[model samples]
Target: MNTTPAQLPHALVMIRPRSFGSNPQTIGSNTYQQTDEGLAEEEMNEQARKEYDDMVAALKKADITVLSFDDRTDPVCPDAIFPNNWFSTHPDGTLALYPMMAKNRRTERRQDIVDYLEAHYELKQVVNFAPFEKGSRFLEGTGSMVFDHTHGIAYACRSPRTQQEVFYKACETLGYKGILFEARDEGGRLIYHTNVMMWIGSNIAALCLEAIPEKQRNEVLTSLEASGREILLLTQKQVNSFAGNMLEVSDPEGSPHVVMSAAAWASLDSKQQELIKSQAHPLPLSLDHIEKYSGGSARCMMAGIHLPLKPGATP
Candidate 1:
């Protein structure tokens, strides 16, 4: 398989339901848990499941190739739909498994999923990084690191869920340079995932500039400029709506399409919408319940696999 990043022309996105989980990195995860008089645990899980199914149907209607998984098993994995945090695929057909920070989340990784993909798709190599979990070092795959494949740059924000060592190793192994920085929300709380603040597309990037500290903002700006990507800066409010978490995907005809949540689309200003429309067609799906309950939006649920087209190409 061709290992060159540029060779990847397709992406694999997962539809998430039952996405609500008690993630340690989320700002208000505990609030989602069952309370004495609030919603029952089973009810919340059921609602999340319904929302996930609706979002999946929306994506399918948009012509996005989705890989749907069932969650009918025991010890429900609430965050199973957001697979990007646990695994990533490369153009050379290499699959990299990551170590997650949440104990319940670690169970999201299913060998059966890999086996299924291998049975249908052409897989070249599998690299496991789950050993870091034993050492208490975590790096939640593409959720923690956003890759600019065209320029060989991997952007990451430092957080308890993203370890520097693991981030550096991922960059080195993938032949990319790491641009690391710290980001915080208005409350001065660290952003849980890099996807919440920025998303790198083929020739453009949607970013929440206000979330990045003043000290690191210039560096990020310089890097984006150096990479020759157009910057679509978003506000904190828009980021909360999942605007910055949008993903750029291509159709089977090689037409580029930008995928975002309906909340994200509604949050964009007319000018911002025009700017994005000038580049690619916008595909929005409603994931309101998933975002509110899981604290992750459309982009978090999709894991873009940079796999080569043919089986013999290097990834």
Candidate 2:
């Protein structure tokens, strides 16, 4: 395997859901979300938990450090498993909390997670964008924007959950140049999250160019070209299978691995799989139950830990 780049984090933070199900607040915007008519709510929750455990196990087996936490029931959050939306950590010792569109999702943010990070990592600063929620403006963490930290570029598509003004402000705060564009689904609806249609790694980027408008598509292509990344074009059908919702991470030894769902893996053609394998090792986790109901895949479940470790802190 090749040496891992700065864009690939060595550790991840994942929340195991106790009451996982379809979120009513997010279903409207999230066109990818679907309901399993056969399963009861309780059965769905059990399946989600099992899928979560299986995913964590697969990740750990690949030598990735996973900081796992259980969801709280005090204020029930059905979409709590998708932790990448709430907050993000940076290599510059910065922790940022984002403004969520759904009222129920706002409760996913936990003080304990912040405290634990501060205790173990070198957290130099904390930036909160949650105040924007009061004005009904939102810019979800990694969900709304995909950061190519290696090149200091933030790629985002215009959507209800991703306000342009807030996105630009976030880019300015993080010292990144923002690349904003319009991407719509097949039915002419805006894709809720940018991550669902694109994923950027060290040298490779998978994107669904078909979803983007012709006029604004060139800008995205130009930016990726300027970064010298090899682009992999994905069809809308493949994207619906969660093909673009992939994350590149690394093990402690700096071996790069592309974490994705089994469905995503199956969606890829043989040639595409070969190209991906040449870039990094593919680690596919079975998440049919979780992906079918919640509308998110492997990338959404993991919040990458980019902060540096503190003195004497164990990995």
The parts of candidate 1 lying over 4 Å away from their true place are 1-9, 15-37, 309-315
TM-score of each: 0.88, 0.97
Local distance difference test values of all predictions, in order: 0.75, 0.92
lDDT of 1 at 238: 83
Which candidate number has the best lDDT?
A: 2
Residue-wise C-alpha lDDT for candidate 1, range 162-206, written one tens digit per residue? 889989988887778999998787677778788888987777787
lDDT of 2 by residue, 1-315 (tens): 225567987789999998799888999999999866767878998899999999999999999999999999878999999989999988889999999999999999999999998999989999999999999999999999999999999999999999998999999998999999988888999999999999998879989999999999999998988888899999998999999899999888888899999999999999999988998899999999888888999999999998888888975
Candidate 1 residue-wise lDDT at 157? 90
Residue 310 error for model 1, in Å?
Answer: 4.6
Q: Candidate 2 local accuracy as lDDT?
A: 0.92
Q: List the residue pairs that clash in candidate 2.
A: none
